[model samples]
Target chain A: MRFEVKNASFSYKNDRKIFEDVNFSVDSGDIVAILGPNGAGKTTLLKCILGILKLESGEALLDGKDVRRMQERELFKRVSYVPQAKNTTAAYTVRDTVLIGLAAELSVFKSPGEAEEERVRKVLKELNIEHLIDKKCNKISGGELQMVLIARALISEPEVLILDEPESNLDFRNQLIVLDTLTKLSKRGIACIFNTHYPSHALQRANKAIILSEGHTVCGDCESTITAEAIEKAFNVKATINEYSDGGNTIKTVVPISVIR
Target chain B: MVEKKSIKILRTVLLIILPIATAIIALMIGRIAISPKDVFLILTGQGDMVETVSRMTVISFRLPRIILALFVGAGLSVAGCAFQGLFANPLATPDTLGVASGASFGAAVAILLGFNAIPVQISSFIFGILAVVLTVLCGRGKGKGMTMIILSGIMIGSLFSALISFVKYVADAESQLPAITYWLMGSLASTDYKSLIVGVPPILIGILILFILRWRMNLLPLTEDEIKSSGTNVLALRAATVLAATAITAASVSMCGQVGWIGLLVPHMVRMRLGSNFKTVVPASISIGAVFLIIVDTVARSLTASEIPISILTAIIGAPFFIYLMRRGGSFR
Candidate 1:
């Protein structure tokens, strides 16, 4: 499915405008990263484009259909959102937490049965976190918990996966684990959109990037959207995009110099 | 880890039997100590050997009260379970939204006006619903969280409590005040068939509705965006929960004023022992809560010649267990 945001804008009451006329579109098997500095409304833009928070004067179209018009049950079945794993509030077990992602399959009177549990098992196995199924979600390591949350999103069987800071607040290894999973999922024809603080993450894995920073908006084609100029403009820091070769794969890393206006 | 399927089935079977066993035991151990055989014989209408007074004690007095206790316990516990999950707060109870205090104020007003049992119950039910509505009105706002609802509940609860005191201030000291005061403390001594007929339906209907909605309610503890994105209408689900919880609580309070702690105590017990699945927690709460109250009521009447208030016994029993569970730190799940 192709998800498109057209002329979208938002602002809080009595607060300055966050963004205006921001337009972007992403399609299946695409890894799109949304990057911005603090208070640039990266998360807020993600929510608005998804119709979670209403756009000020634009529409988010899923396959040319207005998202607001689509029933939530149908919409969520095709699109899934994942919060940061550690943000989980309840002490639900890993299995149950994943089971909740199949909310579209459940009704007021109908709960998940054997078939659903079997699906949960399959999804967890696919994510290689089946071992953590019975463990309390609170007990799992942050990286494992992120995998569990991914399993939850996959269990919903959505075509589009949007995540808020999917790899933030993680150790280097765990960050790699999450980023690699995103690449894997996107390769499987799932459109993965995620918010990130790191510009290199967007440059490294994203085929498409939307940069929301300092009243400047750039979209489409990671090559153009993630330039050193865009980085300096977005994050207000002088930075260099360094290139290194690791095992025949060219890696790009953003190195920050000093704060700049 | 989750329990084995067979063991879970066994626990369910045992839970279903628990209340029946307690109720039967309660029936036999009152002031007039009737034998098991005689109690059974009386129930089966074959008790020629049992005295009329004993039969009356079992059939007319204890039976109605036991049944009342069963409904009251089940209602309060299920409400508590639902409320706790709904708010994602362990301390949230059926009365968390001030339904109990609302009902109590209604009953106090009824007593002050010299109303009978049925009218008192009706008044209580209406006011109970009133309190929940007021709480929602006071608490609801865009992007507000459960804490707002809880704060509103406390505010409304205190408002009703103060109203009850006002009713007492002007109540007939010799008659109405004692009646209102005793009713507020909670008791099952005044239960009869007529009142039960009016009261039990609300509790029963509420339980049945909640049981029907059991699957959807598992989403109760999730964060707002998680729930909103789940494709289900969370507002409808939450509204249904609040309505059902209010109905059962109002009905229970109407039948017997403010039987405290069953909601918190029984649900936590069920959750601690059975895990946090509402699939198990809802039914377990219904079964165990009934049994818990039957035993408590029996002890209340039998332990002392003058009947002790049911609330006192419940608090005496519930507070320590709650503290123990709190200290252990694994029960909330």
Candidate 2:
């Protein structure tokens, strides 16, 4: 499956164009990371793709079909989105929260059946959250909550998964867990598009990277295209790229390395 | 696990027992010293001791009033719970959308226009639906957030309230003014089988709808994208739910005048006990709300020689509990 955005442009009030002529595509089995600083319209771009926000000029298509024309349920069947972490709290059990993912596939009046329950259990186990299944969602740690959210998203068995800042609130171990999970998901032929501020995670997990700056796509490629110059230019910070003996690259901010006297 | 199950069982047992207890107490109070046996006989349609006057008072008058109280209480509370879930805010209630005020204005206008014999019951039902439609139209925004909807409701409510006040001023001083005042204060004094028959259907239908959609209502607090990804149409579902809730609320208010507190407070009481799952919250609210209002209305009628307004009793009880809940951080964000 290919998720394509062709010359997509969006504006808030039909006056201020947030992004103009943004283009990208993600193939099945591809892990694409969108990297940008704050206010770069990375979130907006994701919304445009999800059809939550309207496209001003171009279209976002899934498998050569216009996303806008696809019914919400049909579009959701193919693409699942994990939004930014919400502060809303509910006393719903983790199982209940995850079961809601079956809403699109289930009829309006029917509850999840035996097969769906088994699938939910499997997904919870895969996310290493089987122990937390009966616990209140509001009572979980942030990382666990994120995993629960991801597990919920996976319940739909969507081909394309878009996450906005999945790693934002995670600790180091959880971040690695999420990255590794995305890698495993990609290997299983699921296309994962995640927006992140962390470039190293992108370098480790993403087969392709698209960098947005000032509401425009500045660069697009695999790891080689995301150079220290591009990172420094996009973030407006001075950085030095170090190549390891194992043929890996790390970009570190040189200016922040030394303290002022 | 056994203990938890026992606790749930205990809660369910208590829900059943509490309403019966309240009804017994309600029957025992007031100048009538009807024994439990006679009360039972009257209820079961037997016993020579059940005199014509007492039978009429108990079977026809008090029984219907109590039943109406139960229905109105349950309806308002469930509607409140649904509204809270729909708006994804604790503060959201029937009044939040100005349904009460809108209905009141509609009813008031009908009264002032010499539509007295048209039956206050029918006037309220029509106005209640009208108010909800008007509120929805006024409060609607193009992809706006919950805050915008709430603000729009407040503005519309104020507008309707002002209109109601103006109507009150122009109402015929000799006949309509007093009726309008009594209606505004809210009473079960005029409640009868006729009004109950008209009001109960919509209220029951609305509550049933909320019961069916309770789980889906749980998803409203989540982000739009999250809800969509979960395979639900957030906008359509929310609109439908709000409409259903508002319809019930309007019908209840029009039927019973403006019985406050039950809609706003009963859900909070339920939440305090059972947590916020609509599965437990909706049913608990219905039960507790019905019982609470039934008891209060019983007290209102019994405590005075003449019937007192239900709102006065509700406010007296509900406001202090609301304050206590707020202070105790039950309402803290």
- Clash pairs, candidate 2, are A104-B231
Candidate 2 whole-model C-alpha lDDT, 0 to 1: 0.77
- Model 2 residue runs over 4 Å out of place are A111-120, A214-220, A244-261, B1-29, B47-49, B116-159, B325-333
Q: State the lDDT of candidate 1 residue by residue for A1-261, as single tens digits.
A: 899989887888867888777888899999999988889898898777556788777889999988888898989999998887766747778878888898886766887888899999999988777889889877788888888888888898899999999998789998998899899999899999999988889989999998886578888899778988888888888998899999999999889999995
Docking class of 2: acceptable
lDDT string, candidate 1, B264-296, tens digits: 899988777767778778998999999989989
| TM-score attained by model 2 | 0.87
lDDT of 1: 0.85
List-wise, what DockQ does each model earn? 0.58, 0.43
